[model samples]
Target: MCTYESSSCQTGETVVIGENNPVGSGNKGKRFCPQLVGTSESFFIPVNIPSSFSLVARNIPTDQTKIRSFDCILRINEAEAGVQSTFFNESYILCESKEYMYADDLLQNNVSVSVQWNGQHYIDDPTDTYVTLYKCSVNGGSCSRCLSPEATPSFLNCGWCGTECNVIESDVCQSNRFVNQNETNLCSAPAITDVRLSHNYFF
Candidate 1:
């Protein structure tokens, strides 16, 4: 459901890997339903995070019918980060989150994210993707040499391990920092409202 445009049939082209369906049980008689042929109108799922608890939607492909392939990604502010996916049916789920979606206390005082009055400083993990995330709002300068794509992964801040910043601000690191680590404020602090998810993309 990620990019529904009737693109290709690569997902269906395969030999019987296991004995789930009937025809696939016999070799040379492998069941092949790889190509999902159709025009897909992506659904708009909304995920508004209310204070108290965070919500995660696992194995989202199960909820969708006629699903050929599906994937879900995470984002900070609006910058896109790396995404995970599943082909046909695998052990992994279609959609998943890190952790800590909401809390009544998070709605009132300083949240898991560092925050001051300056408006959501460079503190990391505004969305609380994991238990411990670092926020570092720095200009995209020699970042690959300074950070880890997994620790602070983003198109704007992603690279091989130990590769510092190599691009400009708009093309790379901007004003926000989202490190999936222990609470380490690389920049300053920023007040956060409830962490939010777009239901239009979820349920």
Candidate 2:
């Protein structure tokens, strides 16, 4: 069993969402529990792509007694772009662990987070673990999964729509002598004024 966030939660905010008795085997939770270490990763929609944001945890054991590898997958509109693992195949952990991933090199706005550990067992139940999630937003920009009617569409490779101007950089847009109906690039495609100015020379 694993815990995942349904929506964005701020970093450093803690919530207790699970509980069970350790002594009672009938329906009692595991006698031993590992606490969740606090660490968080954040992501933003690309400054030019179209996508949705999500945080996910997979392969996590609900029992808490057993130690095994777990994976965290970050998705953009459910599209896979990045993945990270915890308690790798070679290692195991008796307690919940924390893992972190920084911004950069994201694909489809996908990110994976994982952890590695050495495992052993101990008995003492009545404990809880929490998964904390945070979202990264630009100083004055908002994130979106699609472009507005006035905004230009992003390159196919982009993951989320962000605060930067973009053009379909194909040969058609580059040629001053040719006007291609299929190609269109705009200087004010982004929602932010500064971003539009930053790319002003390109237009």
Candidate 3:
């Protein structure tokens, strides 16, 4: 059995001696080297608004000197968060999102954390950790703002009917609704009140 304090170990060594008491070299056997092991705790610190928060990782293992740095990756739901900042540290890492991440960015109000060595190297900690964030309502925005392409977190899924926001597949916004999911020119058509009919007609 190996303990936490044990760095290395060897097992199953055999030694054979000749009849004249001549000692022969013994087999070194299999040796086990020390492995990186640690636990990570993460949390979200609200920086500016409910949609903006800084990711903080703590209590990471820093016993290995060969590990140059740790890469803290932020995952929204199950996909990679398209933040511009790259967080790096020796024991822990702190990263702030460049773009705003709204409540719609998360599936369950939680963001996943994946800590790696350097860039692509994996660590001994296989378990994934998550940090919970404040859930802000995505509804109640103007039709133009809801359907605008410049909106942060492109997955906002805002509907252009009476300023409502929801998943693209939701039936909340029914008539005169334009979802901001995929289709383009959704808000190009003028509203019913914007059309003015001319009285004079010539054939």
Candidate 4:
């Protein structure tokens, strides 16, 4: 009497793919240690910056990849801005149009930005202009923008353009209202001394 034990009895059945080739050799391959990372932070390095240099802020659309063209008037130590405006010769943003950069590194040192945000350039006017002063380390790595002491920071201005008046006849820049963010102020441009770069975290 042939008796099949339920604990260890099974008819050997070969599971096979009915489609494809009837018979063939098989080989496999793969890769290991795949590397991945994301590094984006703007940097401003000062090695041998031209005494006079100019760059466009290249505002990118916050919602999409569109570019905004605006002039950045930069100056150093209460100096004239246009004097250095001619030296500008580079594109800061990746997008040809106003497209928001993924990270600050996209704009940092890659773009030539004067450290100082001196308000002498724009004629001071509380009602018409808004000024926003940004502080940065000499190394051009760390930066603090908008001098909001409590509700309102110091030295920095916004919502009202910028400083509404200049030093009477300082002649640092043309008499103008600070409407555009690309507009530059008399800042210790390009080659600023150790003392020139403000490390102040607050006003």
Whole-model lDDT values for every prediction? 0.29, 0.30, 0.43, 0.24
Expressed as tens digits, the lDDT of each residue in 80-198 for candidate 4 is 23221222122232211111111222212222223111222221111221111222212122111211223223222221123322211222213543322223343223455566556
Error of 4 at 143 (Å): 28
Residue 183 of model 1, lDDT score: 25
Could you arrange the candidates by TM-score from highest to lowest? 3, 2, 1, 4
Best-matching candidate per lDDT: 3
- Model 3: residue 82 alpha-carbon error in angstroms: 6.9
TM-score for all models, in order of appearance = 0.19, 0.21, 0.33, 0.15
Candidate 3: deviation at residue 90, Å? 6.1
- Candidate 1 to native Cα RMSD, angstroms: 20.6
Which window of ten consecutive residues has the lowest lDDT sum in model 3? 27-36
What candidate 2 gets wrong by more than 4 Å, as runs, is: 1-36, 40-69, 82-203
Against the true structure, candidate 4 reaches a TM-score of 0.15
Question: What is the per-residue lDDT of model 3 for residues 45-114, given as tens digits with 9 covering 90 to 100?
Answer: 3212323233333334344444456554557646675332244333335454443354463322666655
lDDT: which is higher, 2 or 4? 2
State which candidate, 1 or 3, has the greater lDDT.
Answer: 3
Candidate 3: list runs displaced more than 4 Å: 1-42, 45-68, 82-91, 100-108, 124-127, 139-203
In model 3, state the lDDT of residue 101. 53
Deviation from native of the Cα of residue 134 in model 2, angstroms: 14
